[model samples]
Target: MHNLYIPVIAILAAFAIIFGGQAISDSRVDDEIKSLISKQLGVDGEIELQAMKEVQKGYGVCGQYQVADQGQRFVPFYYSKVNERVTLDADAERYRRHCGS
Candidate 1:
């Protein structure tokens, strides 16, 4: 009985580790997407990347850009991890135009 319990615990632990690693990988991907979007927009300021809690409605990452001259603005950019692509929305285009991107 004890041997059976140990195997089950090991399997559960392995699953936990795999899931945790995947979560961390997803987070890093989100951060990289935010960084790429910021660079593309020519944003030279403080930037914060946050994951959207609801994946269906919003971009994978939401970027908060704090400009020295114009305060701050929220930018949304789409990120597809499987495809490794990032894109800005129409509103983001307006933001780039306004911020002199």
Candidate 2:
């Protein structure tokens, strides 16, 4: 009976760890990420996600927000990881300067 209880407790602990980690990472409104988005985009609010063909489409990592500059919008946009190393190319150098990364 004592041995059976040990296995039951171990299983419960494993489940708790798995689900707890998943819940934390899946949260949609992380303060740190939001602050970064706000700082980079120079705008803040709900991210626009118009489904109509003629409407503006918001894009971001994890599909959460728009990151384009006010006057520099473009289709097929791109975003680099905040921690990614800056490449030596002119475009990448410009990006690093623009984002202060």
lDDT of 1: 0.57
Provide backbone clash counts, one per model: 0, 0
Name the top lDDT candidate.
1
Off by over 4 Å in 1: 51-70, 91-101
For 19-87, candidate 1 gives per-residue lDDT tens digits of: 999899767875676577668778765555543432434433333333345555655555545455555
For residues 8-100, write the lDDT of model 2, one tens digit per residue.
Answer: 999999999999996685343244444555555557653332111111132222322344344333212123334522222324544344333
Roughly what TM-score does model 2 have, to 2 decimal places? 0.40
- The residue pairs in collision within model 2 are none
TM-score of 1: 0.56
Task: Please give the distance, in angstroms, between residue 18's alpha carbon in candidate 1 and its true position after superposition.
Answer: 2.2
Query: If scored against the real structure, what TM-score would every candidate get?
Result: 0.56, 0.40
